[model samples]
Target: MSNSLELPSYLEKSAAVSERFKKLHRRPVKLKVEDLSKKFETPKGELVALNQINLEIHRREFITVIGPSGCGKTTLIRILAGLDFPTSGKVKLEGKKMEGPGAERGMVFQDYTLFPWLSVKKNVMFGLEIKGLGSQKAEAEAMEWLEIVGLAKFAEAYPGQLSGGMKQRVAIARSLANRPEILFLDEPFGALDAQTRASMQAYLLKIWQNVDVTVLFVTHDLDEAVYLSDRILVLRANPGEIDELIEVPVPRPRDPGQFLTPEFLATKKRLEELIRPPELAQNEEIPMIRLTEVGDEVE
Candidate 1:
């Protein structure tokens, strides 16, 4: 036998993935966070929501941030979006310091924030028009985005007239029509049903592939994070800090079928290990009260 030892299949695959992402790494950094920190004043005392967070998002990269509740994932994204501020450190976008909310960044939230009174086309054109584009130009651009999102037919419809998924498509179109350098989505599909959520994920990937925008998605679903992210930012709770920035080994041009593949499973397993609470990681079981009697079997 040869003297060389065999590496595990996942490890072997990781080598190929590293090669694939080399181009991605070479791309210019679109957003940079250095020693970013945030604190909140609780009744008890100062609670550090995020501590010394550092990150870099490459141009046109899709990054997902996931963690258990209280991990400050939302806080971190909010700061980057300029919707909130950090107590310390700095956020730079395209080599310029971010002071407050600007057109360079676009944000989508779990809630459908469409203006109910505005038609779908107008909703998309809202930003363009605000930026002083002529009515004809803004409407034309809005229709183009609606077409890209497969919602052109519904351009005349109102938010209340559309399905949950359709509304989100409009929201996405509105954000993208502005052509922001980076898009921040905080659980944009959390309210959708499982089927719709999966559909939205596919749509998002297709959009990301074609668009020239960078994405930073915040989600609580492991499957979602694994399926959508080029890299997953795993955070730990209690003075929320970075646990790991996982480069997903799953190959690109991804499909739903890849979820069961070794690479996907391996990455997901590692994420679980990192995000699992210490008690659970230690296999410590919680005591439960016996509400049902010994013979309470219903089946």
Candidate 2:
């Protein structure tokens, strides 16, 4: 008599995903957030953006933050990246307290931030030059990063000459050329079209796999969160706080095909539930004004 039990298909996929990232757990904590909170003085009074948020990002891990609007997703990343100060608590990187913006951290915003006057390679070399590296050395390192992002051929091109995705690739190469320990991306692909965005996501994974930097991405796209993250940090709105830190149950070396898999679909479903408001989740009806003729309604 066999006593072995068959697990559901989703569970099988989940188990595989877990096994795939088990080694990541063994890695040291790269970024640690403790009792972090932020508050703003508004016309209505004090508004809390983040409340007592705590997190530990593992070395070389890709982490994404997602939540409803005004959930402090941007605020959280800004604080972590040293672009903004937290009202309380501390953020540490590799056991050292982070005080201010430094070369060790890189950031990419949603908008293209390339300098119009500089060529692609020059854009990448800007930071290196600021760090006091010789022009030849900086240019050499910049070209190397461009090659890694598959944009070496575009080195001589201007920002205006490149596509949305290409500009982002240049931005990434620019950030990476600094050899930062962590890269903060605040919806870097938000400005791209759907097809371009998908390709950018794939390109990002390829870059992350090759680079040693840890990724902290802020996004509104649930699919992007599930696709890119080793774990997705879901924040709650109205005095933002950590709701759940989900370990994505989709195996790595990810591809577009996996989007339809049981595990991927299951994970995405959970995200929708968490991020969607209760009213929406319950499918509550909203009063609608009739603008067309009664029989004119189209299914």
Candidate 3:
């Protein structure tokens, strides 16, 4: 519960981060999925969530999966994160078959998964503790991550004492403390108020810049995806499929003002078309363009 961050004496170099930026220039794929398909059988009937979904997540890639409700965005990310098995096809990490969840994979859920009774530091150390790290090591590592997320000062605070944004930040610190090779975010900020959501988005962008962990974020927010992701995977509903893989042209350490720029507007408009089909397009309204920067506006 101390405000001190007890990280390792030596900072761990994120090889994952290094590879991500390297591949950006070379454009090499890091994770590959070959014809991935998934289905579910319920008491009601058979449900086809994803079909013939093929894609590659490059190293250190900030890829956002955006789609309408019922699209297989969540299902796809679950499979990639090793939380679910695909009915068909295969997924490989750096060409090795992915069997299940490991230290290499970490998840941040929409709901705050923190143990309410546990203080913030304890919650952040939970994953490391599960990995069998010693108490001193685990506490130190947890504090370091909490510090990175600007929550070291709240180490003794419980989840109930924190706001939605702060809770999510703790979740992020917990996920990052172990230095996972890839981080899966299932609408991590979806529950926050608009102002808080924007603030978290900016905070996340800064973290993505500072760290090398690969991120597969799922959300229905086009602007959020455009603002944070290096590349985006657009999925369509009714038997989910990878309809398009659009690359955001803007550079890293992004400008929050980019949202107001003509280029950003154009990209958001294009994403709407991909996310919305003919019928839905009629009722779809343009998302509000609130162009304000919060926190570290860089990236």
Candidate 4:
């Protein structure tokens, strides 16, 4: 395989389509997250996971939700994907209240979520087949998405036969096959090795730049958050809340070379500080903090 996979022609943006997308990318938020909060009633008392989280995501925007544990990163993505409901506040998708899981949105979790019994193509076709899209059309859509992810050759393989990175690519293809308005990713590359993780990060950015969907990504990796997001939504733990929203001023069509550029490095350093703990931020003697201890969600 090539160091960089080739993108199919169908994935390319035509002159007219590109022009139209530029217009649609403007204001008139696609998702309105207003006063969002989630609390779970535990035996001890009300355990607040999120509080007063507000954000507006525009069409074709790549926004990443990140913070320490207990910061409600998972909860926020779940609410936006319609897998969970906010206790107080509302999430509007294109001006409509998001009630529950719908075809308009899709989610790719840390776990591949592939059926052990199904092949790659079958797994991607599951949703469309249920939606009443005939087998032929569903297969066609699945093939296109598989190609988009550089997994066209593995469409006949089962999950067990593929590597961790390949499995994640299949999961991504499955989600994109549905043509969702927004794709919610919860640490999709968290399980891979360092090398594979870096490769997948680049793959994800390639797909995102070509596709027209809005993205709400959740991650604990500071570098991943900066590399893939148009804006980073920083959350605070102890009842998760929005602390700040920082933009990635790097020019688009990003490549691995940009990772070393001054602008990219500056953005990454800024994000690290934004999420730094009060106790650690003041300690100049401490060299670094363990990832496991950082931002642990309130138990």
TM-scores of all predicted structures: 0.91, 0.90, 0.83, 0.84
- What lDDT tens digits, residue by residue, belong to model 1 across residues 223-273? 999899999999998889999888888888889999988778777777776
lDDT of each: 0.91, 0.90, 0.84, 0.84
lDDT at residue 218 of model 3 (Cα atoms): 94
Task: Estimate the lDDT of model 1.
Answer: 0.91
Summarize candidate 2's per-residue lDDT along 127-161 as a digit string, tens digits: 99999999999989998999998999999999999
Model 3 lDDT per residue over 166-226, tens place? 9999999999988887899999989899999999999998998899888899998888998
**What is the TM-score (0 to 1) of candidate 4?**
0.84
Candidate 2 lDDT trough over 10 residues, lowest sum: 1-10
- What does each candidate score in C-alpha RMSD? 4.5, 4.8, 12.9, 10.4
Overall local distance difference test of candidate 2: 0.90
lDDT for each residue of candidate 4 in 91-206, tens digit (9 for 90 to 100): 89889988898978989999888987999999999988988999999999999999999989989999999999999999888888888888899989999999999999999988
Which candidate model has the greater TM-score, 1 or 3? 1
Clashing pairs in 1: none
**Model 1 segments more than 4 A misplaced:** 1-16, 278-299
lDDT of 3 at 164: 91
Q: Point out where model 4 deviates above 4 Å.
A: 1-25, 278-299
State, as a TM-score between 0 and 1, how close model 3 is to the true structure: 0.83
